[model samples]
Target: MITPAGTTAVGVDVGTTGVKAVLLDEAGRVVADAAEEYPARYVEPDGAEQDPEDWWAATARCVNAVLARARVRPADVCGVGISSQAPSVVVVDRAGSPVRPALLWLDRRGRRACEDRADVTGRVLATTGNRLDAYFAAPKLAWLLAAEPAVGQTGAGVLMANGYVVSRLTGVRSCDTGHAGLTLLADLDTGAWSEQLVDLWGIPRGWLPQVEQPTTVVGRVTAEAARATGLLSGTPVVAGLVDGAAASLEAGLVQHGDVCEMTGQSTVVNAAFEASRLRRDELGTMSVLPYPVPGHHLVYGSMVSTGGILRWFRDEFGDRERQLAGLDGDVFAALDELAGTAPLGSRGLVLLPYFLGERSPVWDPAARGALVGLSMASRRADVVRAILEGTAYGLAHNLEELGRLGLAPRVLRSVGGGARGRTWNQIKADVTGLPVETPEDARGAPVGAALVAAAGVGLIDDLAATVRTRQGVVRRVLPDADRHAAYQRYYSVYRELYPALRRTYDALATLRAELAP
Candidate 1:
């Protein structure tokens, strides 16, 4: 394939809810974008899995749609990049077929496996810069080896979701440093897989893929991939970072003291700092990993179910909103309007948005969602408002933790689906008592992936320079003093809910497991 002088780059983001592909021009403007949804199977209360093949199919569909929509020829695509949900375990055979369903980052079936190795907890944390938890891929891989030994025996290689797509695209099995850091198998200091950690978990070192920099050109789109996805054969494929890091890049968080709040299926609050400022105590609760930009690291806290909680409410309780949506109206907009009708603090109602347990600040896998202070006067809209406020409180909780580490944001750059809601953005601003900035382009991760692809192909000289030139804040929401004062009262109560119910949460988890078939 001959590349044109005016060629573009394609960035594909495989998220928890769907796959989004964006095509960007030389000037970093989005020429076209498309998205396709897929299902995450919840086999059990604490288990979440997805078919690797479904992700590949969604990627192909999204890429083809974006290319066709842009009216660009295959030869006009200069490079391709991918960003995806990380720490997801996909074990593949020698022929690249998945031996079993990929365990999602939210899957907690491996909690026992993670806890059984408590003896090496400090060593693992020191080596990987991540604590021992079911969230990391190593624990899930260990669980699979124990529960499904046959699959492990047949597994010739292990890859993250983005690596799986990269292998299908170019027949190269490789992972980026940002994604590798999440696996708990990589040495944070050396940026490579650790032999001691691998041996400690009893994982064959051969099962892991090679680690590469986020912008490195790992391979080219092969003939088969071209036919399936409509991308040009031999187009350069860059190793991409995880979705949160990519979104952070797009939010221009390379500079110190700049924080990004990515509100998607999950809300990730990340602050960047020079590598010299890394501390061990903070790593016990949050993740401290390498950023795509060299010499900088990202310290982030993730809430596993922020936006997913709203989706749960919309599906289970918002029947009228769904019917309105069927009539060519926006359901989320309607829900937002309903939430707007409620008073601040939802008239004494408070909700815990831990629908899928939680990740940051509170790493308890056994935690569950709860709605407190409900009364007969409470209406559905109040519940809706409580959900939104609850999520904001969670964001504020993460921000407080970051503040303790002296990495708090003076101004939070908000990006992702939740940023689109004016009411919700204002709620976040009020709850966090910080100014919230939203970029002109809400397609956060995909835009960042495209920027990385452009840099990888030599179209852009520097990632930070390109971001500064191309990205701009279109809107800013400042904190309302009155509203912030009111939210602070509820926020105090919100902070107490989890600690008050810790023992109850554990007991309920035990009772539920005992009653399960």
Candidate 2:
């Protein structure tokens, strides 16, 4: 193995549900890792918030654990890199104290505002290749400014999770292009904050963090941050990409002709091109990021829920799995086995996996999950299989929408826990009619963050070169033509269910609200 010179760095991922610090060598080998979970508080159905303090505390705990487990001198770790859920709207006072809970990416409280402000959708997208969806920070910031009077009146707005972390570490607020692009704030052409959008959203541009390149060294660890986390003062911190973008780089999909499907709490598809391939509406949005090389851009579309649908099932139906597990089989394995036995299309059972509304294609939060075609003969296996296949069909739907933009990916690089399930991987391949590839190192986002740190400190020349040299391809799952044919029929039905039942879903939401505690 060709080892990198003076190899050790920590990549911290501030995710939706947790914060993890992965320690790696410059060659991208994992040394030690630590993670801490924090709550994503949902005060109401559409609301999501987290304390910036929780993130800093979790980050500190995870980093210290990594260092202790690795038993290496702090000096040996040359640099640090960060990756996080993007486009959060956080407010902090002058002393770097959070004025209010950070409104997270999962937050949908701003959807109404986004829908009402037509100018944000078109004007922002024209410059940034994005939409005025609640997923971005602009509308969330507006919601925050209106909801929290004190924070709005006196504090500055930080663009994302990493920006809050940066301010804590350096006592200066900052964000990078990948994160800024998600905020509906950055001008895709100029790579600067959009003044017109800022004015329209009623956000003061000064409240926005200073923008930097993904690899730009922001600042050293301040003494306060150093004490909280066992790190050497003056350590270089790289401006990191958003979690999905970093994961794409780790999966070796940075060059044109490569596509990455990051399946986590949500599913995101990012494709690299020589230049921007701008498209609007039905196809989704475009955004710019610093490529492993200069002057390259990444285009992507995102869905609000994917594996999350499975997680919902696992948590809700865990008792079913547990009952089976008592018989000496692993729960997920048993569920996989049962789902495998069910027919490709789940015996006429079709599911729309939009438990938390929808993202991508429809971009409607009011959308709800539906299980159509139930019968007296239906079994648990059929229900489980329908859920799995339904999520795959949703992915296929996203692909079809991307087709409107004229992007036909030859193959998709799959990352995260979803890729580990053999049956799930095959379902995606067959449903999407595209081969799915996995990386040898499966924990992608963290690995990508570490590689960026290595590149940041000169251990590697750039991210793409680092990924190609270090990351290995595991295997490819080819689409089953026969399975594809069957799914095509079922998918046609699945597509219609959402439109046919949208009004019913809306009514159900109102009823649930009326019955809530």
Candidate 3:
């Protein structure tokens, strides 16, 4: 129900691979939605970059499309919300023009900065409640400052992906707590930037953007932006959230121990908790961030390259499925259906879904993807099934880490594009031995953003109250005891595979470096 009735909100997500826009009405139903895919530039094997301008262009196109399809005038839309991939380093000059391509969340160029701070890992852990990883913004910001130098242009700005787009749309530069915590800049305890951490990185303190609460309406759409995108010139726009937090909110993770896993480019299993009740290192394998919801914190066990692995497989090996797929066909579902005939346990096959190395629990950038137990009799279906089961193992690996911390979830809510895969969802359930609930519409973050927008502009009273009353629209997948029990053997092997091949991964890394021209 709309608090005032008859109002709508628009939400946009600036994702790593695409831009998605959704128009939602009062009943929490999507009136219209559209998406546009954009590619990331991989100039170096370990480096990833993207033109921030491309994100804005795509976003404007999507917003216009969404508005046109919904047939809603700009004046009637209540507010606008945006969420984006977290902790990316997007440097802009005084004018907010792109100084260089944004260093994406996937970029590993800052790993050296992490290694450079090896002596202070404990301090960083204490300060940010998170280990130093290249995935965070501050380290990459340091790399950009040093490597590009222009990023340090006295009045230049450093922001995340969402902040950059938001600035383009509303001319406000701000970040929320979720992305702030990962920056290795925000003191998780104080919920603000720490001077010590800034000194630790030798970063100029002035470059960081202001941090605000997720639902704070930071600005209104400017006339310039309204012309570029089909938004009202004065529509309210909130500070927005990191995609994971928004996805978690949309998945019904309202209470403590409400576990949810977002299966997108990566699979991050999140569990909420009270920050005061937990010690700094209690979540060592995961990072703790201040939740968008008040008085709560989120622990994230991020598994790198989960869904990306499936996309890679689809592009490289699923030619038949793609060819047979009709208009707007979902290649993932088609591929999963092909695997239906494959035996459970994939007939003694194992796949390590670490094609782009790994994160969380392992923290091994040199880790390699591997397929074992293949034979002449092995078919494409077996390999596809192995891929699904392998990603499930990764998810289970994360759940195991959470379990050790006394935050084991009773059930897992799957959210994001990858959560729509029935075979994959079931496989994850069986492997993790947890009941999984997949939403009828797995695209989550955008909706959460819209909900936050509704709350920010006073269209809804009490955000938590509205979510607590969210309609129960989900497809529950229960784990079969037999399947869960039988998957234990392969799960054990998956756990051991990485350690056994560590030396090989190291050797391969050395050889690749040596062979580089």
**Total residue pair clashes for candidate 2:** 0
Clashes of each: 0, 0, 0
Give the Å shift of residue 2 in candidate 1.
13
Report the C-alpha lDDT of model 1 over 1-517, residue by residue, as the tens digit.
Answer: 2233336989989888889999999888889998877889885558899999999999999999999999999988888889998778799999999999999999988889887899988888888889999899888888889999898779999999999999999999999998889988889878999988898887888888889988888999999999999988888999988999888887888777789899878999988877887876565577877888777888899999988888788878999998877866667878888899999999899998888889998998889899999999999999999999999999998988888888757888898778888889899999999999988877879888888888888878788888777666468999999999999999999999999999999998898788876
Candidate 3 per-residue C-alpha lDDT over 232-351 given as tens digits, one digit per residue, 9 for 90 to 100: 897888888888888887887777788999987788898877766778877768878888777789888988888888888887887899888966888888987977789998888999
RMSD of each: 1.7, 3.4, 2.0
2 versus 3: better TM-score goes to: 3
Model 3 regions lying over 4 Å from their true place:
1-6
C-alpha lDDT of residue 371 in model 2: 87
- Native-vs-model 1 lDDT? 0.87
* Cα RMSD, model 1: 1.7
lDDT of 2 by residue, 412-433 (tens): 7898657777788898899889
Report lDDT (CA) for all predictions: 0.87, 0.76, 0.84
Q: Rank the candidates by lDDT, best first.
A: 1, 3, 2
Output the lDDT of residue 148, model 2: 72
Query: Which candidate should be chosen as best, given TM-score against the real structure?
Result: 1
| For model 2, the run of ten residues with the poorest summed lDDT | 278-287
